[model samples]
Target: MRNYGVVIPAFNASGTIAETLLSVAAQTVRPELVVIVDDGSTDDLASAISGTELPIHLLRQANSGPGSATTRGIAALSTPLIATLDADDLWLPNKMERQIAHLERFPTTSGVFCHWRNFRNDRPDAPEAEAVPGWSRTTMMIRREVAETVGPIVDPPGGRGEMIDWIARVREAGLALDMLDEVLARRRIRPGSLSYGRDPARDRGYLQVARLAMLRRARDKAGSG
Candidate 1:
């Protein structure tokens, strides 16, 4: 089995960090290491994980966007495979087991991602809604080589679109990403969450990343020719 580590970039996630950590602790296939990058959060994030028996490495940095925090966390880990979990999301117990099994079965694929469900924190009793069907960071597990090839996620000025940017780079590199049809995580959409609402700046950043990828592809083709 491939050794894996989990990185969680958290910022002011006092209310939900415990739940996130607990979910990770309950995974059937626990990660070799768990690193939580606290991006200058004023909240009691450290206190939340203080008593947990999970092998966690808590790193605190100056106020940085999630992209930078994630990059730092990834750099600190030595595991061959890395899985990311949002501070507000919860992974199903078999998430790591299933993804790792898929990667082991298909050696050619660079990574595997599964579907996710979105649940509103305010409506605890309501049924969870399915996220748009596709590969997402919340449900992604990738080999270290794939992440190194893609490089760090870009932290936009507005602090969003980093994952989108990274995914675009992954595609440009011609990496094969396999999808697992099962839902492996639950995304929490709460009020005041950075990822809860739409932002035009993030949309523009996505376009910019795509444009850069296209330009790079063109340059590579020209060089090959």
Candidate 2:
């Protein structure tokens, strides 16, 4: 059996941390370890998981932002298979089982991602915000070697676009990414989320990542020629 761990990057997420932890605890295929990196949160994030019996490892660092926090958590875990979860999101019960199965079925792929539904934070019971499902950081399960090869996620100047940059790197590396059609997570659309609103700085950061990806691809093609 493959050992798996989960990394959750949280910043002042006291209100949603407990629920997020509960969702992980409820997974049909539970992870061997759950690591939470608290990025200089003033809130009582520790208290949020104190009551849970889950095997959670908590790490704290200065206000370095979500990209740094997630990178730290990934480095701290020794599991061969790793999954990432946002502190404000919820993973469905079969999320781990399905993703792991997909990886096993497609051994050539470096990672597997599943669809996710977006819901308004205030109205969880209401219809999903987006008609079409999509993939996010929380919906991805990747192998350790793949993550190491892709390198650490970039911490953009505005604290967003880390996942976007990482995905671009993955593509540039010619990694085979397998996508599962099933919806495996619920993404909460809240006011203060990292990707809540558009900002010019974030857009510029994405452009930089895209440019880097293009350069990498060009270099690869030249080397092959």
Candidate 3:
């Protein structure tokens, strides 16, 4: 099995983080290191983390958004492979195992991502395993070079669209990423979550991310020409 580390950016996720950690600990191919960046949570995050025995490196930073937290967590990782998970998400036992195998089979791909299904907070612990395309960071297992090449995730004004921006950069950098047609992650949809409710601010942030990508692409093309 390949050695990999996981980064989980958390902001006041005390209620759900334990379950998320449990899912990580339960993975068939467990991570060598788990970094949790606390974005200035007032909640009892320490208590929530005490329930897990996984190897954890905890970092505390003042109320930065998830993008900042995620960037910091990635900086602490030294493994060949890196994965990201939200503080409120869950992973199937074979998630890492399957991703590792896929990466090994496709040596040229920069990373591998799987599909995910959304479940409500009050729904059954195990929702239907079937899923649609999950192009989110939560389902990604990327090589370390890809993260280094992409650099830090860019935080948009509304604290959203950082992943979109980073993924755009990755593609622009000529790194190829592959997505598996299997479901390996579970996204919990709940009130107060970043993506739960549609907000005008989030919409604006996404647009900003797209605009930046377009500008970058045009600049790269002009330089090449």
Candidate 4:
């Protein structure tokens, strides 16, 4: 199996990060390296991760959005293959194994992503939701070279819709991401999370990123014609 590293971007994720790292440790195919970028979290993120024995490389920076933290964590790794996991998400035990298998089978694909299920903490540490076919950075495994080609993940204000912008850039760069039908990651829905609250600003951020994506597409089409 190819050696791979994991990047986790954390911001005030103390309550949920330990479980997240445990999921990583429970992976059927272990990662060669794990880097956690602490995005200036006011909470005790370090204390939370100290209980785990995983050889985690922790980096700290002023409160940057997930995109910046992700970029920093990815830059710290030297592995040929890189995967990302959000600090509040959980990966199924075979997530790495399945994604790696997919990448090996489709050698020309830029990356591999799997479906994710959203769960709530109604019962504490339990997933109380059905699986859904969706794309999330947490479910992605890609070659290091592909990440370089896709460029940095954009950090939009409020840390909303960065992934949408990045995916648009990926398509613009003529890259393809192969996705599996199976759900291999679980996203936690919690109060006060960036995506949970009914915040108008979040909606605006998403719309802004999408608009930029549309403009980029139009510009590329015109340039080509």
Q: Which number leads on lDDT?
A: 3
Ranking by TM-score: 3, 4, 2, 1
Worst lDDT run of 10 residues, candidate 4, spans: 121-130
Runs off by more than 4 Å, candidate 2: 127-133, 218-225
Q: Could you give candidate 3's per-residue lDDT for residues 74-179 as a string of tens digits? A: 9999999999999998998999999999999989999888999988875637576568877887998999999888899878988889888888889989999898
Q: How high is each candidate's TM-score?
A: 0.91, 0.92, 0.96, 0.95
Residue pairs with backbone overlap in model 2:
none
lDDT of 1 at 182: 87
| Residues forming the 10-long window of minimal summed lDDT in candidate 3 | 121-130
Q: Rank the candidates by lDDT, best first.
A: 3, 4, 2, 1
- Model 1: pairs clashing at backbone N, Cα or C within 3 Å: none
Number of backbone-clashing residue pairs for each candidate, in the order shown: 0, 0, 0, 0
Candidate 4 lDDT (Cα, 0 to 1): 0.85
Which structure is stronger by lDDT: 1 or 2? 2
- Let me know the TM-score candidate 1 reaches against the reference structure: 0.91
Model 4 quality (TM-score): 0.95
Question: Against the unseen true structure, what C-alpha lDDT does each candidate score?
Answer: 0.84, 0.85, 0.90, 0.85
Better of 1 and 4 by lDDT: 4
